[model samples]
Target: MKDVEDNGLKNDAFLAAAASELEQMVEQICERIGTPLHETTELQRQVLAAFGFGAVYSITHRDRLTEPQAHALSIRMLIKPFNYSEQQAVDFVDDLIRVASNEEVHPLMNTIIHRGINGHVQFAQEDYEAMGRNIQEILAAVQQ
Candidate 1:
């Protein structure tokens, strides 16, 4: 894995302060991603209900991994015995961190991050996004 220059993005204080908000985000994200695949057998969801809960754990460890590594791990850990292309796995991770990672990439995605940025702030959404970035880069960002 490539080593990103440590910029000081390790402080998860924002997450600690925004537990409820994160939880709510997890619930909605997990529900959307964990739905049963109609094309699959068992007439049941693929037991991915744990993704919402499990993803945060994986995401928090982003500092220890490269973006590519994180994406690969996301694929391996996210889907179980079920088969999905590497793209799907990669996209899945991208979708999660993307919102918080880059606000300018898409304006709509920034809605949550922009919520009262200067007043009555609920959370440090940028830090949440930084959590998904390269460890070294994150270090520098956090240091700022």
Candidate 2:
């Protein structure tokens, strides 16, 4: 019981910190790119949907799910909420990982961090550009 409580606290802290950092990064990227973040686009919607599942499942599973597990959960989420075909959901998640994180292995595939109940977000640089390149690419892809 004690261990469960402690672990829950730890994961909550980690997720909160991740979210805050991600928010700041988004703002900085937008500022550097000379545009606000795109809030309503297909890609954005899909990512939000995936992250929404992350937000909930991260709490429910709590350091128990792997990236593949998180990903499988996301597929179901996208399908139900967005009414995406199974293949579309898979592609959306895959494209999300590729275009956003520039990763290959199931995104968080093997991290002990949050038991992979996390997104593989990469702000590769924190310069005058404020990591705008990645954001720019995403915007371009989604035509935002």
- Top lDDT prediction, candidate number: 2
- What TM-score do all the candidates reach, one by one? 0.30, 0.42
Give the TM-score (vs. native) of candidate 1. Answer: 0.30
Candidate 2 at 73: error in angstroms?
12
Off by over 4 Å in 2: 38-125, 128-130, 137-144
Would you list the clashing residue pairs of candidate 1? 4-136, 5-136, 6-136, 7-139, 7-140, 8-139, 8-140, 9-138, 9-139
**Can you write out model 1's per-residue Cα lDDT over 1-144, one digit (the tens) per residue?**
223323223323333333344344433333433433434333122223123323433343533444554444445543433344567655655664665466676543333223322111211243433332222232233246
lDDT on C-alpha atoms for all candidate structures: 0.37, 0.49
